[model samples]
Target: MSAVGPAEALILLVIWVVPAVVLFFLIYWAVRLAIRHEGRRVPSLHERVTAEREAQRREWAEREARRNTEAPDEL
Candidate 1:
């Protein structure tokens, strides 16, 4: 067989290197996503805080509504 020419080497490099990089990134991202999921517990701190704040707001609104209804209006 003849020695491989520069053109042939370039074509082979492109054929293999491009797909290898694409597959590397796909697996990398998949592993990252899996790892991120493994660390979670139910109601993460941020979620718990948000839920608590929302509950407080709801309770305050309910209390205001009850107070307004019970207290007579004074002109």
Candidate 2:
């Protein structure tokens, strides 16, 4: 068989490279979108922990107040 010409080689390169590049970008964007969506769906661990601590503090304060009122004579 005769050797392939430059134009034919360039055309073949374009056909292969274009689709591969497109596919790469498509997958990249899909993963990024999934991560961003999941971030919005769930609360962060730090926020959850802070909220739990605040709740515990409020509970402790209420218990202390109740105890003080019940035993006003003690120092």
Candidate 3:
């Protein structure tokens, strides 16, 4: 059996390690992208419009109450 010198051993380790590291990163990126795309669809337009209208109505009501309190002279 031939003894492996330091340079030959190092080369072999790098060959094995580099491919494993690259494969790990590729798998990680693919899984991350898949998870991110999984939630791409959310709140239909109707739902979004309803939510916005509700928020605007709430704001308008608060403003009206504040104006009435400040203009007691009008009452």
Best by lDDT: 2
- lDDT string for model 1 (21-53, tens) is 999999999999988888774777998999999
lDDT of 3 by residue, 1-75 (tens): 999999999999899988899999999999999989877968789989999999999999999999889886653
Ranking by TM-score: 2, 1, 3
Candidate 2 has a TM-score of 0.48
lDDT of 3: 0.93
Poorest 10 consecutive residues of model 3 by lDDT? Answer: 66-75
Instruction: Look at candidate 3 and give me any clashing residue pairs.
Output: none
| Ranking 2 against 3 by TM-score, winner | 2
Q: What do the candidate models score in CA lDDT, each in turn? A: 0.92, 0.93, 0.93
Q: In model 1, what lDDT does residue 56 have? A: 100
**For every candidate structure, what is the RMSD over all alpha carbons to the true structure, in angstroms?**
5.9, 7.9, 5.7
Clashes of each: 0, 0, 0
TM-score of each: 0.47, 0.48, 0.46
**Could you give candidate 2's per-residue lDDT for residues 11-68 as a string of tens digits?**
9889998889999999999999999998788778998999999999999999999998
User: For model 3, how big is the CA root-mean-square deviation?
Assistant: 5.7
